[model samples]
Target: MNVESIRLINFRNYNSLNINLNKRINIFIGKNAQGKTNLLESIYMCATGRSFRTNRDKEIINFNKNEAYIGAMINIDNYEKFIEIKMERDKNKRIRVNKTELKNYKELYSGLNVVIFSPEDLKLVKGGPQERRSFLDMGISQIKPVYKYNINRYSKILFQRNNLLKSNKSKSEIFSLLDIFDVQMAKIGTDIIIERAKFIEGLSDICKNIHNITTLNNEDLTLEYISNVQLLKNKTNMEKEYLNKLKMNFSKDLEIGTTEIGPHRDDIIMYINNRDVKTYGSQGQQRTVVLSIKLSEVELIKKERGVYPVLLLDDVFSELDEERRKYLTRSFNEMQTIITATDVIDLEELQNVERSIFYIEEGKLII
Candidate 1:
């Protein structure tokens, strides 16, 4: 899939803008804080109905504005699709496809696919477990809408169970609800674990090679899916294990006023030469690992969807070296990529051809 054009209004620094994009490579050049990242975020929001920078939808609207709007025309397998997103401060967000309002969010995930790489992605390896879990959840949600539904349902159930615990409810009363929640959580959580395991397994194959190329074959990388509970080992024993763990942690969870154990707490561990990369790996190694994961995401999405997902690189070129930059440029020849950077010299040196270059200053795009 490729984005043909994008329209933004009252989104971050962009007041009002509309621009057509090249299917191959479109570059946005601007200095820092000049709305370069905002442009890429707008395209990501249009594709996923979520922002990569912030979680609160209200923050996405320009200051003093009650709402923000983003629209895009995407081409998937030679078919054109129009996607529109409206974000309001006090109301639920709205999404429309081909001008038809969607009744459910799952309806929006059918055709649109995008993979975003930004400087912050380095956090996937060095940051806390939440970041890694979020990475898995977001990718899975895009490819499998059912995972979205199950996640929402499991989260709701977990919330209610936590509330019950904090209310000083009787053990018998809470236990019943916990049993139901545990059963459901294990079922959904196991599915998530299974899918993530498979994804990481597939990703390792590509990441290893990519990391070797990026590091001049000096370092070896590995990705391992780490979970609080081992559910993949025995499907028949999963329910029992889930129930026992919840029971054992009941008092602790009640004291904390939260659900403490489950897939929500899972994480991915990155190792280089059998050592934890987050703590021991150099900055260059961390960056290369992130790049490998992202490129692997592009390949995985293409394999599953039968089309390449649109690639969005937000100000990441400045952080890469010349050799790595060339490697990234060579990797994008088979996919559609939109990159934002402060200058075009590096990009110009990497590839030679007809490309769309937009100059972003303040909130204006000078074509």
Candidate 2:
């Protein structure tokens, strides 16, 4: 998959812009706050139908404008698709692939495939469980569009169930209503947990080898999916396990006024040589862990989709040493990569690689 071109209007600091991208390597260089990362965010928005930087869509619009637009022409499996998004300050953003508008963001997941790595992604190892869960969900949703629907439905059910727990209804009435929520949550949550488990299982295997290579085979890496429900080798009965857990946790959940056990509370534990990377790993080890996972994501997408997703790098080289920087740039030849950097990268790293460079200042591009 490749993004052939992108046009932005009133997106972040860009008032108006249009650019064609090289298929191999396209680098955007600029000082901080000059709309470099904003360019990548626009392509990502087209790929996943959401901004990677923020949850509120309105924040991406220009301060002087009430609306913003992003249009991109992408090629996937040898066919060209036009993705159009219209964001209004007060309403839901509208999306269209070709001329047909998507009914929901879930439908847009398969429209474009992209794997993004930014400075913030280090949070996957150093941050809370939500970040890790998001990494799993976003990575899976690209290849499995229905996974997005399951996530949305599960989240809605979780929200309603939590509200019901906090309501002023009698214990008997609340328990009666919870039975229905419990069954639905179990079935949907089971789907989520099962998929997550399988994804982490596959991603773990791929990340292991990549991490080894990046670390010169000096350290080992592994990932395990942690769920409240005890998953078995045979997942045919996982739904039952999840339902029983939810029912068993009811009194505790009632006391806390919230649902406490499900996929929403799941996490991925990263281990380096049998040691918890989050707590025991040094800064370099943590960075290596995240790098391995991201490279593994690109491989997994290619494995599942039969095409490499567009790789977006947001000023990540500055965070790495010369060795790790070379390790990352070496892979740029394998797929279409767009990078944002505040300064020029090492010329030696770009040797023999086909590339295009664009400079940005105050939302304007100079090629």
Candidate 3:
């Protein structure tokens, strides 16, 4: 899918802006804090109906304004689509597809895919377990929108169960209610774990090739899902295992006032040459691992959905060396890519390529 154009109003530093984006490589050149990342964030928000950088939608609104608006005309498989989102400080965000209002985020999230690579993604390899799990979950969600629904449902149920655990209910009352919560969690969390395991299997297969190329055939990357409960190969046994663990940890969960034996506590482990990258990999190795993972998402999405997801690079080029830059961009030939950089030198190799270049100064786009 390719974004044909985008319009922004009172979003971050942009007061009001509209610009047509190139189908193949749109580069935004600007200094730090000049709204480069904000531009990419807006596109991401339109595609996913949420922000990647901030949790609170109000934070995206302009300081002097009470609302923010973002709209985009996207081309998916040669068909055009219109997506719009409006956020207010005191109200729920409104989303519309092809000018029709949607009741929930799920209505707008399906079939709109995007993979983003930012400096922050370096955390995928070097950061905590949650970081890696988020990376895995999002990569899976882009292709299988249904996975996002299950994830949201699991999250909500988990919240309710945790709240119940924190309440002053008696042991018998808590146990009775916990039985219902555990049943629901086992079903949803099992789906999450199973889908995550399959996605990791696919991601590991693709990332191995990508990591090899990125490292000149010197590394073998591996990815695995690590859950608090043992993952039995049998589906029945898997759910039973999770349910058993939840029961085993119920008392501990009550003591801690949280639901702790499920997918929420799960993680994705990354390795290179049989060594845990999180603990043993150097800075360069970690970056390469992240790059491989991000690029592999593009291929995995294409294979699963039969289309390449749009790529968003937020000021990450400055961190990559020349060789890695070439390897990264080599796959950009046909995909829609939006890159943010501080200067032309940061994207010198692409300067001569057929592309669209825009300069941002104080939130305004100058072509």
Measured by TM-score, how close is model 2 to the native structure?
0.97
- Over 5-79, each residue of candidate 3 has an lDDT whose tens digit, in order, gives 999999999999999999889889998999999999998887788888888999999999999999899998888
lDDT of 2: 0.90
If both were scored by TM-score, which would come out higher, candidate 2 or candidate 3? 2
Worst 10 residues of 3 by lDDT: 345-354
Give lDDT per model, in order: 0.82, 0.90, 0.87
- Cα-based TM-score, every candidate: 0.94, 0.97, 0.96
Task: Tell me which of candidates 1 and 3 scores higher on lDDT.
Answer: 3
Instruction: Give a tens-digit lDDT track for model 2, residues 94-115.
Output: 9998978988765685467889
Error of 2 at 44 (Å): 0.5
lDDT of 3 at 140: 73
Q: Cα lDDT for residue 366, model 2? A: 79
Q: With candidate 3 superimposed using the best TM-score fit, by how many Å does residue 94's alpha carbon deviate from the native? A: 0.7
Rank ordering of all candidates by lDDT, starting from the highest = 2, 3, 1
Reference-based TM-score, model 3: 0.96
Clashing pairs for model 2 are: none
